[model samples]
Target: MSTEQIPEGVRLAPAMVAGARIYIPEPTWCDVDHASENASCVQDVDHRTAPAYLNRPGSDIESLLHVEGFAELSGAHADPVVMLNDATAMHPAQALRWAKDVVAFAEKVETIARSVMPELEA
Candidate 1:
């Protein structure tokens, strides 16, 4: 048997539901109806708002990620377009806070990465 290794910095969001960690990327907001039913709520994370990580043009980390969110919802899931590359998680909301949070978290990661590998900016 084979199993996929969860990426580094990846973690199960504390606010996850539906017996699954996946959140639907549609709707652009958390579904109170679904949450009231104790179902999964889609948390959209837009990392594009963070310009620090993008400072290093052509960087793999920069191109590999974007402003997006992920939720398993069920056994069937979709690959996250932008992996925060950190262990932080956030709840779904209609405000830009989620997107800002993703960017902030990503920036923190970049800061740590630069501290260890200064060449990351080159």
Candidate 2:
């Protein structure tokens, strides 16, 4: 075990989103498609709205850019409703695939910590 891995005393914590320490989730917004799906009385209505106003735009890590992430990775236009439905249906199988993903992600994190902040490896 690395000696530096042990904490010697109290230290200030990392910066966090404002008000997040209270444990309340931030107010969320949905695209028109999601909003209509939740707010509508019809269960089988097709969501055929323009893509411009349908989903939040940006990178996934920057925010929860649902269909945007898929579209970016896939280099194609996205259908927000169908993509979300697929995600929900596939979530269990998707989570099971983490058996391989977690090892790589954890190793990369530890490698960067040991390289950039050697004190953390002590």
Candidate 3:
């Protein structure tokens, strides 16, 4: 760890990367257990939220999502993104639009469900 003073409002933590100690900016949303010996914190790498599982009403199928935020350090992209499992990444605005569309689709599904099962109207 460097003796350099950490700036106010900024948090830096030391991590071992490739067998060398380095400092990395820690984000508030980062839930990584840095105390663990296996912790890996690399600069320019993304800090991500805990995986959230999304499941259908009555199915074994499910999906996972995570919101990842990156720092501008090392010339890496600083934009925050929503990642679907390991396949897709979307900008915050795109994620919001997609969420709105999902809401609308869910409403349509609810309407169809109610029509088919009038008991659901209760």
Candidate 4:
């Protein structure tokens, strides 16, 4: 038999917050008919995660993930894109917000990586 590790080189650290639910903060929703059918395919996470980890004041992605929301959400679910659109329809503001969030998040991550891996300068 084979066993799999959680993949974190570092053990679970205290005071470390997981932002799994922030990316998709809207609650488990139903289709227009208000049915839970479409939601079945989506995995439901603990409700506590959103309130505790998500829900930040910053309008940008860093504000959205200043505490590591991006990492957790990506790690937690596999098909968030499909799930997000399928879960519930988003308005224009949602689209705009997401775009801004992603751009800001990418810039910050790139900056951090460049700092850590100075070889990027080459």
Candidate 5:
């Protein structure tokens, strides 16, 4: 994708990290799209606050654009009406297909990252 092709209401910036930290995830709400048979959600819903580990260089790196599907919910604000546990019902065949999708997505993220941060590539 070209710079001009980025989503309209999106912004990107660079920042320097100082130390290790953890972040709490914000709740995400989505409605089921009947036409596509998928959830209508936002991006970065599955991304970790800290994308890399500074303490251990080259540690098991994750895709910057990580994607995850919701399975269960807990806590005071948990909604029994919305949360689904269908992920538990995934068959071995489905798991394999999902794994292949994740691999493809990671490759796309790597390509985009390289295009934007060519200097950071080793």
Candidate 6:
């Protein structure tokens, strides 16, 4: 890939894709341990962010969120998406809007928590 085609903060690195040697862009936030002998780094010609999680209070439930960007060569699915755990995928714009809603809900939760425990700090 040409320097002009690379995204900011990404570096091209050699990898085996579909039994052929190719260079893949690795972003700064990528958590794939490419050095591992058994690493499964490639994901359908896409790069992904490290997973972020939010755990429920007093419960084992945890929610995961991550972003995935498909390589330009990925054909029809070249657009980036925000993945919610393993369940949903949203475009960046949609994810931004959904994030606003999540912030509002979190604020409401904080309010309720404070009402129940006045000394609680968010």
**Backbone steric clashes in candidate 2, count:** 4
lDDT of 2 at 13: 26
The ten-residue window of minimal lDDT in model 6 covers: 64-73
Q: In candidate 6, what are the lDDT values of residues 1-122, reduced to their tens digit? A: 79899998788766666555667777655555443323243565455566667766665565444334322325544555677765587887898998899899989988998999999765
Q: Which digits, one per residue and each the tens of the lDDT, describe model 1 over residues 1-115?
A: 1125444444233333555544322323322333233443343332122222332565665453333344443332233333343333334353257577767998998899899
Clash-forming residue pairs, model 2: 2-122, 3-122, 4-122, 5-122
Candidate 6: the clashing residue pairs are none
- lDDT (tens digit, per residue) of candidate 4 on 32-57: 11122233222332121121123345
lDDT of prediction 3: 0.60
Assess each prediction's global lDDT (C-alpha) against the native.
Answer: 0.41, 0.33, 0.60, 0.34, 0.37, 0.63
Model 4 alpha-carbon drift over 4 Å, by segment: 1-85
Against the hidden true structure, what lDDT does model 4 obtain?
A: 0.34
lDDT string for model 3 (1-122, tens) is: 34366654446765556566666766666655443433333543445667666665565565433334333334434555677665577777887898898789879988899999989744
By TM-score, rank the candidates, best first: 3, 6, 5, 4, 2, 1
Candidate 3: list runs displaced more than 4 Å: 1-10, 19-22, 37-45, 56-61, 64-78
Q: Considering TM-score, which of the candidate structures 1 and 6 is the better prediction for this target?
A: 6
Clash tally, candidates in order: 7, 4, 0, 0, 0, 0
lDDT, model 5, position 62:
38
In Å, residue 83's CA in model 3 sits off its true spot by 0.7
For candidate 1, the TM-score is 0.26
Q: What is candidate 5's lDDT per residue for 1-122, written digit by digit as tens?
A: 45575555323322222322222223233322222222233221221122112233355553323332332224332322211122243433565686688679879978898999888755
Task: After the best TM-score superposition of candidate 1, give how far the Cα of residue 46 lies from its true spot, in angstroms.
Answer: 22
